[model samples]
Target chain A: MKILVCISKTPDTTAKIAFTDNNTKFDTNGVQWIINPYDEWYSLVRAIELKEADASTVIHLITVGIADAEPVIRKALALGGDEAIRVNTENSDAYYIAGQIAEIAKHGQYDLIFTGKETIDYNGSSIGGMIAEFLNIPYVALATKFELNASKAIITREIEGGEEICEVELPVVVSCQKGVAEQRIPNMRGIMAARTKPLKVTEPVAFESLTSIISFELPHAKAGVKLIPADQPEELARLLHEEAKAF
Target chain B: MPVLIFIDTAEGHVKKASLEAICYGAKIAEQLNTAAEGIVLSEVKDDLASLGKYGVTKIHHVNSVALNHLDAQVYIKVIAQIAETTRAKIIVFSNNADGKAIAPGLSVRLKAGLVSGAVTLPDTSKGFTLKKTVFSGKAFANVSVNTDKKIIALNPNAYKIETRDGVAEMIPFQAAVDDGKVKVTKVTKASGEIPLTEAEIVVSGGRGLKGPENWGMIEDLAKSLHAALACSRPVADAHWRPHNEHVGQTGIAIAPNLYIAIGISGAIQHLAGVNRSKTIVVINKDPEAPFFKAADYGIVGDAFEVVPKFTEAIKKLKGIA
Candidate 1:
């Protein structure tokens, strides 16, 4: 099966989120970046799993980012993907990115496309679905497990009060979630192989430009802690009603 | 022909998400000056006509046992066929699990402009622009639906259900049903008094309660408030609570109206899942802890010491103590 895994580079989870130029753009100064955790954990690893089960399988990882994203893209290639493509541009708007992906998927015509539910940076779970729309294929989001047969793939996902199991035909878009597969670390041999792997640099097809990032701001700060004596149950209750107005 | 809402049901009874979807679709249909129609999957116990209260004029029923369960591909195929047969301009989903799975699939099939996690009605002044939450509820974005066919997935608890006096006229539509390859094996359910996702009020605890033995306080507070019980990732990892009870970025994402956190220090991952909650109350002994900064109400105190008293007060206030 030909699988296309879309990936992104995001700020490391431990990075102190900050804004630059009077809260305009996310400040990258002193921030360490990594492959967005979802892409790393679910998408890349799952693709690797398929490749391991079938040596003929081709898992291509694609990213639309500036030149700086090459290292992370290389890391994803090292992790499991057989090849990598970097759409060398900073046009990261959901639409433009989705369009860029649609261009690749439309041209390549991969049998199966996989993405992590959302990027840790943008946290927009809308892209894979949008790409699916752009390509006009079936899409299943937040899939925990998958089983691909002759011409159909079965996806199991969690739902409210219970779980849901769905089956779709081949050539579908799927956004995987946590526990879809265990996180895998790159071995020395795989790391070495990744260095020589075919890394393709492609200019994205000209599309509608992105909407500007208006601004970025931190969330409003909550109130300071008001400690009540652990032993004083009455005092706590009184505070919930009289002051907090929560009760 | 207009707007089609997928009315979800279990054992033939309509789910709350379905009501929200109907209201959302009907309101959107009103915006477009088009009448709203619905498609019920299986043998819903509730009368399809009763859904008229939400302003749906028609309920297209294809009573089948096969559709009692969900298959995203099949639903996408069937809904697309239905949309094509009816010539629906816009399709709306609840942005719940089924919506998350099917909306995009349908979008792909229909080649429609799609937006998920929509919070408000579309801005119709120009081309159809939908506002959705971004950056874990910290920001909003306006996405334009540039395609001829448009698909939208509305978030639950984001839209209020509007009910009026009207009876939906039942219409049976002949749909081509296919038994897909997916089948249910064993369903391991979390048997709880309250499921975390559906709970309006949630009382969650972390290491602040100190140990598993002290969990009684959190449970008592949750019970007193008739709220669901949840824990942070650490607690679930430590096996202090079941895995299903964990709420965080890596766990379940919930946006309950009121979230009460006791002892949790507010990790960023944990906040990502719950930052959308309307009201947050944090109770911890450490006043300088990070969670206080995200809390609307903070009581700096030990969980074991303050929770029981807090529970007693609510009980007394409600005259249940």
Candidate 2:
């Protein structure tokens, strides 16, 4: 079985968010980049688990980013991805990125594709569905569990009130979240091996981007907290009612 | 060309978030000097005409049982056909779970530019640009959709629901339904009075609460506030709470009206999920817990003592027995 996992580079969770260039671009200065937590902790690790179960399973990692993303891709490779493909592009538009990944998936003809539920930066939660639409394959979002049964895959996804278990054939795209797999740390030997792993760089295919960021604005800072004494818990209630009107 | 809104329903009733979507679509329609129309694919038990009060001029009902459960592929196919038939220039949806599943695929099918987690109405003064939360609510971005057909998924609780005094015309729509590729095997509904995503107020706990045995205080506080229950990642990871209750960068992201955190230190990962809330109240024993910085109201005290008192205080204020 062949599986493809999509990885994205995002600022670390603790990074201070800021915009640059008249608010048209994210300020990357002093920002520490890491593999998006969902992609690494759920999607890529789940793929690695599948490979561990079936040694014949080949896991290929793909990223749609510029050369700066290679270090993050190498980290994912150390997590058990056999090879890596980079669609060398700087675009942040969701459709364009999905299109690039779709182009690669079409050529690879992988049986299964995995992506994080959403990127931590964009929080769009749109790529896996778009990729599925672009490739005309079945797609599932917010999957918490995935088990393969021969050619059919059983996936449990989070729905409105609860969870829904669904079955789909191979050649499917599943966007994974927590509960799908446990987080794995790379060993020293794995890190050493990842340095020599094949990292292929390819140009992006022609595609029309549907959206563009015009500008960015930071959220208004909170007024300093109103510290109520432990004995005055009722004051919190009074303030929530009369002042904040929270009810 | 009219503005079309997708009405999401559950258990045969329209969802609260969909009402917000309707209001948003209606306001957009007024801005464009066009009519706002809604389409529902499932068998809805609610009075479809009453929804017009939310600003929609018409509602198309498909009345199909197959759509009761979400099938994104089938939904995209049907909604695309409706958009084409209605000549809808713009489409709207609540960026909830179902919308997240459906809107992107529909955008690809229609070749329309789609923006999810929209926090504001489009600014038609220039081109079609609107504000949306990005970086997990750390910041906002004004995105422009240059496509003739545009899609916007409004973030839950971002837009207010305003009702006017008009009834929308109900149109019985006809469409062919196809079998979906994915077959649902079983469903397990969460046992909660209010689903965390749809809750207006949320009360959450963390490791500082000690263990699951001490969760009663958190529950009492949540019950007093009529809020949904949530937990920090460590609590969920330790199996003290179900994973569904976990809210953070990697878990469920929510934007409720009020969020109350007990014993949580307000890690950046946890804040990413709930920073969009309108008001935040933090209760932690540690005087220097990071959560206080993000909170509108905070109490530096032990949860065991403060939470019960807080719950009683709320109950007294609200006249709840």
Candidate 3:
């Protein structure tokens, strides 16, 4: 079975968020980047697990970004991706990025596809379903567990109040979160092998972005903390009702 | 299709988030000089006419038992049919779990531009621009939809629900139902009494609580305050609590009215998930804990002593003793 896993680069979870150019853009001065955890830990790792179980399975990783994202893609390849594809573009619009991947999937004839439920940066959980609609196939989002039996896949996804278990045939697309698989670190041998792996660069299609960033602003800072002594818990409660109005 | 709002319901009643969507759609309709209507696919037992208070002028009711359950494949097709027939220029949805699943598919099927996580109404004075939170609520972005048809999924708790004096007209909508490919077998619900997303007040703990056996005071505090229970990612990852109880960057992102942290070191990732909260209160023994910087109130005290007293105080205040 052939699988394509969509990957994205995000600021490291611990990166201090700041803006530059008068708070018009993200400040990348000392920020570190990593493969989004949802993609690396669940989507990509689960696909690799399937391949390890059946040697015939091949997992190809694809990302949409400029050359600056090559190291991020290389890390995914080093983890287990057989090869990598980078759609050459600096565009950050979710719709435009989804269009580029949809164009590729239309021609690649992939049997299955995987994507993170949402990126840690933009947190838009829209691309996987859009790709499925573009290809006119079944799409599932926020899947926690998946099992492939022959041509059918049984999946579990979280809902508002509970979880749902469903089955879809091959040629399905799924957006994965945690509980699907554990994170895997690339060993020295995998890193060495990844250096010679095929990394394809493709140009983005002619498409206009639907959204543009006007400016970026930080959240308002909180007022200085008002600490209430532990022994006077009742006074704390009174303050919450009269001042904070939390009750 | 006039400005259409998707009303989400479960157990025969409309969800609170959908009320906000209705108001949002109505506001947009007022701006566009059009009417705002609602589309209900499932069997909503609640009185549909009462939704008029939220600005919906009419309700297109599809009363089908099969439609009660959520199926994105079927929902996309049915909604598309309505969009085409009504010639709806814009559709509105509350960006909850269901909206996140269905809106994207509908956007692709209708060849529409979709903006999820919209924080405010669209700025239409200048060719349809929407300001939304990006970078995990760290920054904002202005998005302009280039398509003729557009879908906007407003983030939960980001919009206010207003009531007006009016009554909605209910009309039956005929839709073809498809037997979806996926089959649901079993559903496992989170053990917490209140879902974090829908909760107004939340009380969360972290590694500072020590162990699972020490969660009694935290649960008591949550119960006394009528707030949902949450935990830091480390607590959930360590198996001290269920995964659903986790709230952080990689976990559930919630924007409750009030968030109280007990013994939790506010990591940046954890802050990203909850910084949108209306107010934050932190209690930790470490006076230098970073959570204090972002909290409206802070208490430097041991969790073992502070939590029980806090719960008792809340119980006394609420007359629950």
Winning candidate number (DockQ)? 2
Give a tens-digit lDDT track for model 3, residues A101-203: 9998888888899999999878879989888887878888889898899999899998775677888888899999878998888999989989999999999
lDDT of 2 by residue, B3-22 (tens): 99999987888989999999
Enumerate the candidates' DockQ scores in order.
0.36, 0.82, 0.67
Better of 1 and 3 by lDDT: 3
Q: Candidate 1 falls in which docking quality class?
A: acceptable
Q: Alpha-carbon error at B49 in model 3, in Å?
A: 2.2
In the order shown, the candidates' Cα RMSDs to the true structure are 3.8, 1.1, 1.7
Considering chain A alone, report the TM-score of candidate 3 relative to the true chain A: 0.96
lDDT of 3 by residue, B1-321 (tens): 499999998668898889999999999999989999999998877999999999999998888887777778888998888887789999999988889889998987887888898988999887887877777776677777878999999988888889999899998989887887666667676645776777889999999999999998888889998889899999999999978778888888888888999989898888888888888889899999999888888788898988898788888889997
lDDT of 2 by residue, A1-247 (tens): 9999999999999899988899888999999999998899999999999988999999999999999999999999998889999999996689999999999999998999999999989889999999999998888989999999999999999887688999988889999999999999999999999999999999998888999999999999999899999999999999999999998
Docking class of 3: medium
Residue B98 of model 3 has an lDDT of: 85
Ordered by TM-score, highest first, the candidates read: 2, 3, 1
